[model samples]
Target: MKYGKTLVNDVKTTLKVLVLFVPLPIFWALYDQQGSGWTFQATRMDGYIGFYTILPDQMQVINPLLILIFIPLFTYLIYPAFAKCNFLKTPLQRMVCGGLLTAASFGISAGVSFALEATEPSLPTEGNCQIRIYNPLDCNAILTAEPYIKNQDIKTMGYTNLDIPNVYGEKVVDFSITGCDGKINYQTGSNLSVIEKETLFYYMLPDSFVRGQDDIERDENGLPKIRTLVNKRVEDFNLTYSDSEKDVLNLPSNDDSLFSINPGSYKVQSFPKELKFYLGGVYTVLVSLDNNNDVQNVEYYEVTQPNSVHILWLIPQYVVITAGEIMFSITGLEFSYSQAPVTMKSVLTAAFLLTTAIGNLIIVIIESAKIFEKQSEDFLLYAGLMVLDMILFGLMAMKYKYINMEQNSDNEELENKSERKESNAIDNPTFKHNDDDA
Candidate 1:
């Protein structure tokens, strides 16, 4: 009877210890999803919804909701099935089932990733292109104008002609070329030569002309003779010959000159042709049009391409991470309580709960460090912290030993016996007291 009573007490104690550790680990595992799986999943989602952006951290609520809804169901339905199945009687069997489920969840997410990747943009098409062009101008506006010649003649010799204005409104004499309609006339007393008029259009000259001193040939009177007549009369000069030589001399003079001419006003007849160009296979010029009626200028451009696949790759990683959370966090809580002595069961449960709280606090600290700061660097720091945690957990696993309640009974009994002895000594004192005095 005593043996049966001790066995029943041992079972009760084991159950009580399991109860403390079991819930804490589960809660920890559920909480850990916020950092791992949820975080990874959120990277793939459109955070913005009609100008209302959803933070990745806020998605963590899903894990807690799942826990709240499923914990009781598992306790009532799934736990009973494990107990009745006989095949899953051992804790290792239960752990294996949990691991398989976790892995299966990850597998499902991997399938989702594959599907997402299949839909991802592979080449430059609509929805993935970004192109922006600044202000555009007409090509005709940049073309230089052709040069021409003009001439004027003073019929009476030795009389200065004045008030004659060039096309640019500059007062100057004019020179003309003797062409098919006009012939050169030379007299014995004074010979006449046809001179060319120089028409100045838009021209750009260097500043060196302004910096240097004027170099001109002078007559015996010390006054400079006109080596180049800007605008002069062809009839006033003496001509020795006529032919291509005279025509060559009549050509407009080429000199470094600067002047602003009115731009040619012409209505653009058609739109500019699109320039078909490619920037990698993933990016191309989609549509371009000259909306301004300037055929030489492109006023509108539209570039398109497929969306990126980076987000698709993140979802599977999230699921695997979430699975790890279930295994390490929830299972660790169960293990903590099961290993603890009956007297310290509450402390073990608290320890299990503390790990999750610490994980959450670490996340808060990391986020706070970036509060009011721009995210310039990649999130490698957070990744490093996770790696550190995994390493620490692995080290702990190496040193950890499962608690065996059956073997710990002697220690519990010793503690109980010591307590009973102390209590008896306190109740029945060996020394003579007030009764002996009476």
Candidate 2:
């Protein structure tokens, strides 16, 4: 009877240890989703929700809510059934089951990725445009005049005097005479002189010219006579010149002469309306000026869709990470307690909690380091940390040995004391003696 009672006690202790360990793996699996599966799945969801901005990580709230609800439900409803069932009476069994579920989560995510890819359309090409201006010049003209006087001492003959209007529209007495004298002379009526002696004389008018004036009596188009000008002032006339006219006016001869002058304005027409795609599934457009310094083109483009494999592959990664958490975080908790000395059970539980606290501290330290030294690829850095975590946990599992407190002398003594008390009660029959005295 003592042996049977001892066996029962041993079974009860083992069962209690198993029960405590079972929940650890489950909680760890759920917690790991915060970083891996939940984060990975969030990236695939669209942010637009009518008029609100939604951060991708915000989806993680669902995991916490699930944990809050499921933890209690599982403790009350699911844990009892496991306790009654023989199959779930071990930490190893619970860890294995948790790992399988974690894997299943990743499998679901992979399936979702494929479904999303099949439904989504190919990205559209971006469009762009550019403008340009060619060349420019002023379309104005300049004019100048000079006067000449005559010396009559030379033997020269002069023609009759005539009145002519000057550029100022004032009538002036002038003489146009031809003579053998090489020098030409010009005089106003007030300075005119008559001499009886006949001599050869010539008169030359000042080299004065009108600007922007018509040169030919009939223009090249067979028009009527019009005064020709050397350099015309376009601004004075409030006139604007076109690109073709500006080209003709800017010619060396026309630039100073009254032929034509080009003004400094040109309108560009050609602009591109398309662009090419680049990496990261990110689209970009460019707009710039042309060779002629005009607005060249604005380009548009659509980036290629991300490889379907990326999303599909991450799903499995999520599952594996969750599995790792189940193995290390959850199972480790139970392992720590089961391996600890009976007197230090609370300390062992504290150590299990400390692992999580240390993990969080590590993450915080990494993030702070990033603040000091900016990380170019934050996602890669985070992934590397996770990989490190998995490695560390695996190593710990391999090297660690569970405590065998059941064999301790102190525990054996406590068990023997309880057994002796029970035996004394059976041998002395205390209850029977009390009833007989009554």
Candidate 3:
């Protein structure tokens, strides 16, 4: 009776419990990218941090290091300082503050990518050809681009990806990729201009390399079917939007808007109007106006020109998001226990764990949807969502009245004593084990 009463009667406790889950999935989704997607981003950026050259995967170590620094610093120093200033007196307030910081960090991360996009991909190289294989698995794989390139071994265990260094110095570098199942599938790319090093992008994946032994399976046609990406051309789009929608899109000014359904099938751009693709790449633009609202869909593509940006650019987002994790995740755990009635504490704890699991699942769902292609826009959307969560939670938190745990414990003790007295008077055989009753 007491357990069920406590569970149902505690309106304030229910609200506080809901607060624990409101923004959790969003937080975890972004947090998880630090290990998976963010590491991929690190692959493309220059990894030389001061004097140390950090590997892409090793960049995840910064989160734990930051957590170690945050725990003591926030507990002993920062929280106390904030308390003195009359803010962050409640866990909810601290969580909101942390969420803002997290948003800022993602904003900074997007800024770095934006900066990289602004630069033209230009590099001078004396080498004839280079062969790169993107091996995602831990096992060593051999790569060969026949005729112009051959027998290039790639190891992805410790390194991000392998650029067969020995293949350089040849003048006619052919970009050929012979996959295990078909004809050569490959990319044409300019070496990211470095002072003296090669550049690579973690966000992109190299095709599975073909082995020397697999060459015998080729059909007798001497020519093999080429693998192709499904790039839908912009001309194929059936767009319906007002002038306001066009302005909102803010497409690149260099790309000409003129088009004609021709008698002779001729096409033209105003001087500089070649397709606005990244150097050594082709792209298909996706446009739409069926949104039913004023909101316009905008997309910008970047074919990263190897090592164009600094890796230090990722630090701001990492710092901000880590600070958020300390505030929300760490404090949310403690808050859940504090507010839960003794009989329902375990239930509340399990609910909190459920939020994290669901949060991970959200990332998998979003990726499979394939709707969000740009990382920058995605970061902004996440930041906006978190801010909205903070607003909603802040409102709910304002109405919450904390439970007096010590008082509840005392009442519980009294109830237990009264029950024992009743059992003693009844001379119940199940309750007769204790010798002190004699």
Candidate 4:
């Protein structure tokens, strides 16, 4: 009971100091994301900006470099100016502000992540061919990926899927490739459309087909014509099948399958409404776009896959996070040193570092679960939690009784004055003469 009473007294006295440590863990979590969250985000981004190519790992350099620059800039230039205004008067106030800023940075990151989702979209794996007909009319031409099949079975997976005849029962279809006219500077992965009664396409190709080379032969339209791609010629109709459905798959009639191709350009752009491309295909998700037949020059938007995100987008996040780090990390270290009792200073420093390890442990646990599927959602959660933590810290900080170092200063002054007096006495001529006589 006596020890318990003493412990209560210690807690009562040091509650303010303990509360300050709360935000430190959250700060570390945000700081560490530069290595994990942000790095992976950059992997999906277009890294090339003009002359330089910044890899995903290289994005981490922004964090440390910003920390180095912001610390001095804030300490010498910004803090003093704020100090004069009496705005950030105490350590607690600064820490709360830092927490808020960290939250804001994550919020900004969340927004950017939403924008990225549009370009690199996911597909719904419902069926074999998931055609998301967002609008059939506007898309007069479909931008299909260049044909190159990687299959070992020549008889099964081949160009035989395109066996549909026209209304006249003749094997002639409205197949035409409109070369990119100078009018539209369509980038690779950009969407174009064509209007026909029905169009059948082969999304898959036989392994025997040549991938690197394009088989070109032009029709009267001056557009590059698609030569009928045949893998293994069907020389023998008498074929053996182990599986019952094998005959239906091996012998192509007039229908669509997972391997059937759609009409579109090799160059494409993904949009909001996306259909699931085949699992192991280059095109993961596809958006079917159509035009509204309004009279005045119909303007269609194209969202293309950028090779790299402009490195400039990283600035706001880096700036806000660094600001938080400067305030939380640097100030916390100084606080742990100055506020701790002289004998317990080492113990306090270790305690401060332990918070960082705890923060990392939290991240490891969260990542291991793979709880949040979308990275954007994960960042949003980080932002929200950070804000809530800041609010709690602020309340604690407001009640904190800042430690007084005046007594320590007074003791140092007394020791310095006594040493000066002793020096003066030793220098006195009378004292020196007496010592000589003795």
Q: TM-score of every model?
A: 0.34, 0.33, 0.53, 0.55
**lDDT, candidate 3, residue 418?**
82
Model 3 alpha-carbon miss at residue 55, Å = 1.7
Encode model 2's per-residue lDDT on 1-438: one tens digit a residue.
555545565455544444443223333433444565356444544443444434445555554455556556655776568779765455555554554454445445545545544633332122211111111111111111123223322111111121212223222234333332232222222322222211111122222211121111111211111111112222222111224233211222112222211112222123323222211122212223324434344332232242132322343445444444444455557665766555556765775675555555555665667743322233334443444444443344344344467676467788789978987874555546556676
Q: Model 1 segments beyond 4 Å from truth?
A: 1-41, 46-58, 87-92, 114-332, 350-415, 418-438
Report the lDDT tens digits of candidate 3 across residue range 35-148. 776776665565554545555676788889999999999999999998999988788787777767776777777776566545434322343222223343333444433443
Candidate number of the best lDDT: 3
TM-score of 1: 0.34
Residue 392's C-alpha lDDT in candidate 1? Answer: 43
Off by over 4 Å in 3: 1-20, 49-52, 119-305, 419-438
lDDT of 1 by residue, 328-358 (tens): 4555566656676666567667766675675
1-438 per-residue lDDT for model 4 (tens digits): 355333453355445466567666876777788887886666556555554555567777787888888888987998899999997766767878888888999998988788766655232222212111111112232323322111112121112112111122212222222222331233233121211223323222111111222111111111112212221223332111112222211322111112322212222222222222111112211112223211211122221223234546877888898898888777778877777655456767888998889888878877788879888988988888888888988887777766665565466468768867976874556545556676
Candidate 4 lDDT at 143 equals: 27
Best by TM-score: 4
Candidate 3, residue 389: how far the Cα is off, in Å:
1.6
- TM-score of model 3 vs. true structure: 0.53
The per-residue C-alpha lDDT of model 1 at residue 216 equals 16
**lDDT of residue 23 for candidate 4:** 64
lDDT of each: 0.35, 0.37, 0.51, 0.50
lDDT of 3: 0.51
